[model samples]
Target: MGSLVVFFQLAGAVALLLFGLSLVRDGMTEAFGVRLKMALGLGTRTGPRAFLSGLLATLGLQSSTATALMTASFVERDLIRGRMAQIALLGANVGTALTAWFVSAGIEAIAPVLLFSGYVLGRRKGPVWLGTGRALIGVGLMLISLALLGHATEPLRNAPEIAAFLPMLDAAWPVALLFAAAIAALCSSSLAAVLLILSLPLPPGLTVVLVLGANLGGAVSPVLATSGLGVAARRVALGNLLIRGLGCLAALPVAGLAGAALTGLALPGAGLAVEAHLAFNIALTLLIWPFTGPIARLLTRLLPDEEREQEHGPRWLDDAVLKSPLLALTGASREVLAIGDAVERMLGQTRHAFDSNDPSPLAEVLALEDRVDRRQQQVKTYLSRLGRDASEEENRRAITILDYVINLEHIGDIIDKGLAPEVRKKIGLGLRFSAEGYQELDAMFLMTQENLRMAQTVFMTRDRDMARRLMELKVDIRNMERQSAQRHLIRLRDGQPESRETSSLHLDILRDLKRINAHIASVAHPILDEEGLLIESRLRMG
Candidate 1:
């Protein structure tokens, strides 16, 4: 019974720490998502800046894995160079270590203070305050968990069972290391693993091994997540993994010496585990920072880019499943989802081309447009076969899927024929919008992208509230377009040469983006109508 109590208490403490970490990450994202994204996008111009950006982003997000995956996504978009991404992840590793060090500063008494302040701030309005408040609350919970962790483990120091097990565990350092690595991988957080190790009463040598294990395990999640992304993204993630894996291999042989050195420092409240984690990462970064180029090149050679699949009909519309309406519908849904993804890529390529004023990025848009057309057509046909004998609910779902894919097709056309041509014209003519006008257009582009993402979610879950939110965003996009046009006219009247030269282009881009968003927003229409929240006509009854 006592052993079970201890286990539960340990699990609870670990759970609270993980929860706090999650809240901090989510809060930071909610508060500073756009700015952070902008900073990351703009900050990777050089190796040093890229490292700093990665470090700062991880510090803000409290998860190296988040920073790594974000970097991977950027690589996919060709936003950040592959070498720079690897360097940035180097900083992210150190940032995670630094976070562990900060959390281990033994400030458990301030938990109440942080909790109170967080509550007060969270009660106030706005995303900034709410996010910051939630983050503070998360921090408080983390500190309290630390105290709880300490109290729970106090008995472990003298437990006869642990006393019997410690020597054997210590003797089998390789097993201990793997054990810690597995824990970190499963939890998907090295910081959590290190903290867990911190609470244990263990030999310094074994402690160092476990910390090394955690670091090694920390780099695995990103690699696994990004395995299917792209050659560039895989390189970034795999590079980080290689760095950590090699560092662990090199450190394992010297764990005892390193642990003894740390022990001799006798630093107050400096848990050997976290301190080792911090030092190990710092050392690894310093050692591997200069080798990022070589490692990136190596990863590229090993993981050559796979050939893009030419349109071979629908990848997800399995004909074998057509006998079962439900199964067929599910397959069709997946196929439409693929079309949505392709449409998203088209919009992204358009934005990239527009931003850089380079027609090269527009090259991919045409190919993606063709893919979207082929897949969407196949999906429509696939679903048409199902609804003939389908039940009412199944038929409704089929219609919903059909509606979404049609909208997606329309969006693809707007991007390919409308937005892509507009962007090319801007690039070909070398016309530049006024600063205010450009910002307006760029904001619209980002808004449309976010709406497409939300639309995908709405299509999948059919959640009425989210569907309503998606419906409401149409008003916001319309206002944004109107206000941008008004601003452009104001600039024109003010005699801004840039505005005069780009007026037609600016307005065309805005109009196309607005049209695209309208189609994307249609994903929510069926969900809202089903919930009786959608009216047929916008005209007020006279």
Candidate 2:
């Protein structure tokens, strides 16, 4: 019963630690996600800057895995070179190690203070304050959990069964390593696993092996998370995994020597696991930093790009189903939804290209636009064959489907021809918006993407409330665009160099995005008109 109680206590402490980590990640992301993303996007111009970018991002996010996935996304958009991404992950590893060191550095005395301050701040309005407060609360909880972990493990220190098991694990380093690796993988956090290991009483050599395992397992989560992404993204994640795996392999043979060296050091108050984690990552970074280029090339060759299968015609539109008007209309609706998906993809790529200042991502926009055109044509042709015998309601439904698909097609064209070209021009001319202007445009881009998603839902469900909300969002978009344009002019008048240089480009993008939102919002109009919610005309009493 005592052992069981101890087990629950340990489990509870670990859960608190994980929850604290999550709070920190979510709070920081909410508070400074855009600035962090922009900094990461812009900071990778050189090797050292890239490393610092990753280190700082991980420190803020409290997860190297998050940094790795973000970096992979950037790589997918051609924002950062693959070689630089690898180095960034190297720095992220070190950052996480340092985080562990800090957590275990006798700071639990301030837990109550942090938690109280966090509560006080969290009650305030505004996202920035709320997020920062939540982050502070997370830090407090983490520190408290560390203190609990120490108490929870005190019983195990004298337990004969655990003492017997330690020697067995110490005897088989590979088994011990896998055990720790599995713990890390299951937790999805090496920091958590390492902290847990730190609480256990174990030999120094065994601690080193276990910490190495935690590092290896930590890299696996990102690789798995990004496995479905493009080849470029997959390569970046896979390269990071390979680097960690190699580092672990090389260090495994000398675990004893490394462990002895760490123990021999005069550092006080530092746990063996934390010290080992720091030493291993520092050594790995130094050893692998120079080979990042070769590793990137190796990854590219290993994960060669697969040929994309050409989608010639509508996959969902079947001629045999045309005899049934209801069935045929359903088929057409599904096909139109697919086109909506394609448009969303194109929009995402365009936004990514804009943010990264890379034109490579735009290369897919034209192809997706062509696909949208061909698929819409297929839907129209298929719907035209529904026969003159169709009921009036069925015919009305067919018209609705056609209208929505046509709107989707327009959005695709605007993205491909208007937004794509505008972004390319911005990149080609080395244009940069003022910081305020950039944030305004970025906020609009995000809202536009969100509105597109809502429009899709409205198209399928035709819910009156959602339709109303979609119409409301249209006004919001217009207002945002108008305000952003005015702000751009204000900055230009103030003689801001970035604003002056990119004035035309910024306004053009704002106009195009607003136009796109208008087109997408059209999906809600027919629904609104049918429900007697839509105004017939904006022109009122003379």
Model-by-model lDDT, in order? 0.86, 0.88
Superposed Cα RMSD, model 1: 4.3
Off by over 4 Å in 1: 1-4, 26-45, 77-80, 113-136, 158-176, 202-206, 227-233, 250-270, 315-328, 355-358, 374-389, 430-447, 465-507, 532-542
Task: Report clash pairs, candidate 2.
Answer: none
Best by lDDT: 2
Instruction: Please provide, for model 1 over 1-542, each residue's C-alpha lDDT reduced to its tens digit, 9 standing for 90 to 100.
Output: 99899999999999999999999998887677655665666678688899899889989999999999988987786667788898888889888988888888999889999999989989997667888899999999999989989989998999999999989989988898899989999999999999999999999999999999998888889989997788888888888889898999999999999999988876556789978988898888889988888888888899887787776677777778777889898888888888888898898889889888889989999999888887887888788777467789998888889888889989999999999999999999999888778777877887677678778888888888667767767887899999999988988889999999998998899999999989988888777777788787999999
TM per candidate: 0.81, 0.77
lDDT by residue for model 2 (1-542), tens: 99889999999999999999999998887676645666676677689999999999999999999999989987875567899999889989999999998889988999999999989989998667888999999999999999999999999999999988999999999998888888998889999999999999988899999999999999889989998999999998889889999999999999999889998884566788999999999999999999999999999899987786777888878888788888888889989998998898898889888888989988898889989998899899899899777899999999999999999999998898899999999999888888898878877776777678778899889888778767877987898899998888888888999998888889999999999999999998888888888777888979
- Cα RMSD (Å) per model? 4.3, 5.6
What shift in Å separates residue 253 of candidate 2 from its native position after superposition? 2.5
TM-score of the candidate numbered 2?
0.77
- How many clashing residue pairs, candidate 1? 0
